[model samples]
Target: MRAVLLFAVFVALLAATAVFAYYGLAGPEEVALGVHGWTAMIIGVIFSILVGVGLMGLMFFSSRHGYDEPPQVRKDR
Candidate 1:
């Protein structure tokens, strides 16, 4: 099916990109970049916490401020 072929192509491209990036970054000594990995994890955690806090604040405000009430409809003659 077309879906299967598309999925295969996508996977192939993703693998190719991963291989290229690894080769480009790999030096003669083949050292692992620990700082980059840690930095990524730290930033990811911070961003996730910020998003969760924002969502929680929105929910709390909605409940406390009665945001769930329906709007009043107006009719004119």
Candidate 2:
């Protein structure tokens, strides 16, 4: 029942957002090519940097915490 309720709510919100986005970007004003290109490039570069930083952080943390080490073998079976 809870999951069904959640699904219903998600569907409703999805429909609402679809309507909102359609109306929001349906304007007749033409966006410049340079503006679009720069925006996309900036977003892409930022995303790449964020991903690299997160990857390096995770690698450093795991190495320091010994998460990359193999587990001890059990010989007393």
Candidate 3:
């Protein structure tokens, strides 16, 4: 019952967000992106993608190299 209520609330919020986004984007004002704006946007997107890929690669590298394992205490030292 609680889960159902929580899901209903989540759905309602999503619907409300979609409606609000539609209204916000469909406003009366018209804006256009120039060549420079497009270039900057493309560069920003590429940079973000590169950063994400680099981080994921590092994560996989560390996991495979045993860096993700817990440190064991040296009892025989």
Q: Count the backbone clashes (under 3 Å) in each candidate.
A: 0, 0, 0
Winning model by TM-score? 3
Query: Candidate 3 at 27: error in angstroms?
Result: 2.2
When 1 and 3 are scored with TM-score, the better candidate is 3
Query: What does the lDDT read for residue 75 in candidate 1?
Result: 83
Off by over 4 Å in 3: 71-77
lDDT of candidates 1 onward, in order: 0.90, 0.91, 0.93
- Quote each prediction's TM-score: 0.48, 0.56, 0.67
Question: Which sections of candidate 2 miss by over 4 Å?
Answer: 1-33
Q: Tell me, by lDDT, which candidate is best.
A: 3
Which lDDT value does model 1 have at 71?
Answer: 94
Model 1 per-residue lDDT at 77:
45
CA shift at 77, candidate 1, in angstroms?
5.2
Of candidate 3, the 10-residue stretch with the lowest lDDT total is 25-34
Q: In terms of TM-score, how similar is model 3 to the real structure? A: 0.67
Q: Which segments of model 1 are wrong by more than 4 Å?
A: 1-33, 75-77
Candidate 2 weakest lDDT stretch, 10 residues:
24-33
